[model samples]
Target: MAVPHYAYLKMKLLGPKGLIIVVGDYCKSLECAQAGAKLAESLVIAEEQRQLDRIVALANETPAVPALAKEPAGEASFQPSKETKKVKLKPEDPSCSKYVIVGTRLDNK
Candidate 1:
């Protein structure tokens, strides 16, 4: 069995002949730990970039607008639930053209 002492940066074990010891340099350990942390951060950023790319690929996707039910007065009527707001794309955002923004956090229905 091997026992490690992190504070002393040493590992001790019983060898076939006698007691064996391993030592670690503090500076080297610090450098290696920093490199490991950077690698982990890069991996997370790469994953996020892949997800962003997938979402961006659907830039041309258009949401289906369900036909609103007509009232007895022959007028299309749609009153969103009190918790939801039905908003048409505003002229201020020309890029959003025919898009509708639902105020509620609902799945794309």
Candidate 2:
């Protein structure tokens, strides 16, 4: 059997226990870039926020180090790395003359 033209591609969040995120067209023949953004935001921000909230609640009840610092993963482990960050690419502004949508085959053609 042939593979479908459109499918969700899994993108992994690299970490100790990684997250599997799916990105693909939400609707048939839709702009994939637009769908990718929506799916990424929902998975990255929304799901991550909920997990953080749950962890914060648990930490409050436990007596440990300063609240500002993150708890160690294990007793033998060293302090966690502080390089957690997100790199966002600036979007193309439609108002500027530099933007153009190319290579899309119009149905009418």
Candidate 3:
């Protein structure tokens, strides 16, 4: 009788300061290991996205326009011109744009 070779998968979820947040279960198969790795990666990415969302929400919550000061009579106030220029995006141009793959994980464990 031949003995079956077993593989072990270990994953460590780390924080900004190299602190371990969570530890994954040890997988006996390659497929399970890959799934564990993917899940861990997704968790990290989701946390990052959540933080980004909070920052964006905070930024957008504030008013962009500032209050204008009251001026005296016969005095000119400086006003900025609101001229908008249209921008064209070309997807086929390799130099102008590139494709990015987000939240993709490759596991070799």
Which candidate tops lDDT?
1
Residue 56, candidate 2: alpha-carbon lDDT: 93
TM-score, cand. 3 vs. native: 0.31
By TM-score, how accurate is candidate 1?
A: 0.53
Give the lDDT of residue 76 in candidate 3: 82
Please tell me which predicted candidate would have the highest TM-score against the true structure. Answer: 1
> What's the count of clashing pairs in each model shown?
0, 0, 0
| lDDT tens readout by residue for model 3, 1-109 | 2222233233455557874533334443657878899999999999999999998898799877767887875538654335433333555675775454322232424
> In candidate 1, what are the lDDT values of residues 1-97, reduced to their tens digit?
9999999999999999999999999999999999999999999999999999887776546445656875674346655545666565676876775
Q: In model 2, where do residues sit more than 4 Å from their true spots?
A: 3-30, 66-109
Q: Which portions of model 3 miss their true places by more than 4 Å?
A: 1-28, 63-109
Candidate 2 residue lDDT tens string, 15-34:
45765454554554367777
**Model 1: CA > 4 A from native:** 62-109
Cand. 3 Cα-lDDT: 0.60
lDDT agreement with native, every candidate: 0.82, 0.59, 0.60
Would you estimate the TM-scores of all the predictions? 0.53, 0.31, 0.31
State model 2's lDDT: 0.59
